[model samples]
Target: GKNALLLACMRGDLVEVQRLLQSDKADELFFVDSSSQNTVFHFACKEGHTEVVKELLRDNRCSPASAGLFRVTPFSIACEAGHVDTVKVLMDDNRVSVDC
Candidate 1:
């Protein structure tokens, strides 16, 4: 159930995502959506949706963030997509590795 909701977020279905979020069934904003092969943050970063990314960060209910990072984290995706702002946000978190 949670995974499905996050998947909708990955596809940028903000409307459906908002609906799912409103349901309160998916309180975790950081849930990973494997369909895009990334976390919700990854999708927001890759798509250059700064507002969405900011919103997710503010939620505080997001996942602790993957440690393995699998090289698929928002920071990596942002770097790959050439979105500097996204990269900056993730990089700001010292816990997230960017040397790779």
Candidate 2:
């Protein structure tokens, strides 16, 4: 399960993501990938996975602004990647800071 969640987010697998979220181990949602220090939110945001992003955001534990290996926030990545919808979803979250 090391990268299972990360992979699912990258592929935009909403169903698999939902199922994963229901598991007791769902807290792994914030597990940073070894290579990138990127969480599921990071991958989902960069790839423009709107549904996946929403699902990840539903969990209060997930942080939209979590930094990657070099301290790059998922919000910034989503903007750079042109994921308007994903960015919007993140922006709407009161937990995420647009200025950060």
Candidate 3:
């Protein structure tokens, strides 16, 4: 069920995501997808799941600045995808560098 957390983030299932985060497999949040090299935070931002994004941000393990393919950060991905709400949430996080 390692990938389940990623899928939950992709689907914006806040409840499932929350459950997974509390499980012993919570470390799954730090696993970058091998194919895309993107974190669960990236998927949440890309989908513009504002609540999901918020929940993920609550976890210190969730790296907001982690770059995926082509050096794309979750913030950059959100901006590129025109996910304004996601972008706003990232902006509010001190870990996310707006200057990037």
> Tens-digit lDDT track for model 3 on 1-100?
4488888899999999999999997894569988788898998999999999999999888899998998889999899899998898899999998876
The residue-by-residue lDDT of candidate 2 on 16-75, one tens digit each, is 998888888887556887888888888888899999999988888788867888888889
Candidate 3 lDDT (Cα, 0 to 1)? 0.89
* lDDT over C-alpha atoms for residue 76 of model 1: 68
- Candidate ordering by lDDT (highest first): 3, 2, 1
Better of 1 and 2 by TM-score: 2
Output the number of the lDDT-best candidate. 3
Task: State the displacement of the C-alpha of residue 24, model 2, in Å, after optimal TM-score superposition.
Answer: 2.4
- Model 3: residues with Cα > 4 Å off, grouped in runs: none
Per-residue error (Å), model 3, residue 35: 1.8
Number of clashing pairs per prediction, in order: 0, 0, 0
| Residue-by-residue lDDT tens digits, candidate 1, 25-69 | 666555555445466666667786655665566555553255324
Error of 2 at 39 (Å): 0.6
Error of 1 at 5 (Å): 5.4
Error of model 2, residue 31, in angstroms: 1.0
Off by over 4 Å in 1: 1-23, 28-30, 35-37, 67-70
Shift of residue 7 alpha carbon in model 3, Å = 0.7
